[model samples]
Target: MDPVKRHLPPLKTSINKYNLHAKKSLGQHFLLDPMINQQIIALAGDIKNKTLVEVGPGPGGLTRALLDSPARCVIGVEVDQRALLLLNELKEYYPERFKIVEHDALKLDLTTLCDSPRQIISNLPYNIGTTLFLGWLKQGAAWDRMTLMFQQEVAERICAAPNTEFYGRLSVIAQWVANCAIVKRIPPGAFSPPPKVYSAVVNVVPKSEQPSPILFKAMETVTAAAFGQRRKMLKGALKTIDGVNLLAKANIDGTRRAETLNISEFDQLARLYAQNNNL
Candidate 1:
């Protein structure tokens, strides 16, 4: 037996002990397969002593796996009351190695939650997965890397290429800030209660140089307006953000559609937008 990894009760037993049925409202789908956890951490890169952040660790299946890893510390960000009892057991067993932050991952200030050399690895709750991802993208490269689970469709959107059908504002924003890709496709049967849709694991590592808050906000505004009307030409789609002047400043033809523009073109527009706004 691996002495470091405490042999905890099986997920079903513990889950039954805690009466932790998967909650639909919370998008709860507890992962029981240990192999999946290994693949996720592998994609997280070298976590020898890094702080590993797990969001929505319902029933503590993933949590136990993280603590068992060679990581220096594991923090579980959980908001559900019922799961707290189960996770509390983990905190007791791995007192020095485990910590629990009982707050909504979406509302919590993650920068204040952990130190540097941290990576977020979570089977994120479906409803707030994208919101959490967007927030992380906004925060720039605070973390070393992130391996997260999202509905398969959302995963494709994150890693989608320019001019592709899946590409949109999310694709632009995520690609602009980080190196994102779908590392694995997990089946619904992997969870205790199978979800109707398949889930995918995405790995994100922020780019070396990230956009400043001003420039990022500019990108958000421009992308929203541009992709907001996908079929319209840039001159027409970005009209709300002074498209004509913005395109002229960026020295780009205004006849192109949003999906046709790549990351560099978007960056130019964002920089010009920031300058125009006196930001």
Candidate 2:
């Protein structure tokens, strides 16, 4: 079915009416371009029957665009009282389909916000984007897919390959649990108050097979230790943290640097650590 086109009040009007400005302290760089936002919606794929949880819908720019999509419901979770006030207009426009929740995205339990088979689509606030993405990854299959915006460097890191400069703990952790890709890049100009770096939209679909809770923690511990001193060989980097024994058990070479290790090696290290520690 085609998305129903609803005429929304011009986003500018909401900005002026509410005396709104992008709050720097909140890392708010609102996406004001309809074309770009529609591009993000397209990257999210068929949301006709899907619920979308938007992280920070400042002045309802992307929120309005999302409403125009065929998505069954679009829940805009905003922290700023001013932005929530402006979003109330959207709630009135699509009474049943649109809703606003005033909560900090960082601390809010996103899983409780919607029923099963939901997608998280958002132009996330820069301050909390990485933290929120990592949290979702740790939760494992809580949402169907995540189509989210992050600073260019972060997007690269999430999808970076094992041997690249961008590859690190984030790359291993995200890739181990999902198929990640950078679907679109938005220049700084697209935002209300342009951020210093470019922004990109990434799509992450969680893999069916993930490390067990104990094993996942082991992976976190292993990655933290290895990447904490990424310049050093695994042997030297992990020395204080039982690196030699863990690498030997995982069948990984102690001479390799953390950036050189593949995801499978990391998984092995996690498993071995769990086994050795009786986790």
Candidate 3:
């Protein structure tokens, strides 16, 4: 019997009893589509013996699927107290396989939560999803893989290439540290109380070694400045930074706009900024 099927009765009962409704303020759009949930688990691949961490597991739909997978253990971090009761029930049914930590996922120490070779699989809350991902990246190659679902727009930003409108700071930073791509796109209707925008699942595998730390910092600073005034040319946008002789020092055309520059150009500017201090 499928683990999820076996637990269906209790799961449904809890939802009915609690009258648990997805909370928009929490960015909760519960995924009622089992097939889609299963597909997400499949994308993660061979969870058997792997530890999976799920965030905002409202009513454990994905949590149930994770248990059905080869995963040896599953940990769910949820902020909704109403969801906690249902998660706790699932934990009891699969004592050795499931664990629930009732807390805001963003506030928790994810690295210390499990042993190495950890994988994160979550249909994250839309509001904090990007912020949470940036936090994970900063951990410096903590997880084996991260299969996360996010608002389609944000997903596009992560997978977008330079020269595209979607490409920006997120694309640069994420691609610099991880091999990222959108695995699937989900329609808004796939979720309960359907969200206004579609969602996409993205797979991010951390690299063995990252770019120079100094370059990374500079890239961030430069991108923030450049993109902040996205419509403006580099000459005007980067003028705030001292010694920012856009065309000569950065090797970037002063006439070009922020969106026109690629990751390499950004890195070049970053390296120059770090060395010159004046720029």
Q: Which one is best on lDDT?
A: 1
Candidates ranked by TM-score: 1, 2, 3
lDDT of 1: 0.89
Candidate 2 lDDT tens digits, 1-279: 432344566789889999889999998998888888888899888788889999999888788788888888998889898888898876887899997889888888888988877999998889889999888898777778999999999999999998898999999999999999999999999988888999999999999986677888988998999999888999999887798998787788999999999998888888887788899
Show where candidate 3 strays beyond 4 Å.
Answer: 2-10, 211-215, 277-279
Clashes of 2: 0
Q: How far out, in Å, is residue 133 in model 2?
A: 0.7
- Measured with C-alpha atoms, the lDDT of residue 205 in candidate 1 is 91
Model 1: per-residue Cα lDDT over 1-279, one tens digit each? 765454766777888898999999998888889888778778778889999989999998788778878999999999999999899976877899998999988888788878898888899999899999999888877989899999999999999998898999999999999999898999999987899989999999999998888889999998999999998999999898889999998888999999989999999998888888898
Candidate with better TM-score, 2 vs 3: 2
Worst 10 residues of 2 by lDDT: 1-10
State the lDDT of candidate 3 residue by residue for 1-279, as single tens digits. 856566556556777777888998999999867799999988876677989999999988888888878887998999898999888877777888888887887788887778977999999999999999988877656788999999999999999997897988899888878889899999989888899999999999989986665666777787788888778888888888642574577666787887787777777787788777742
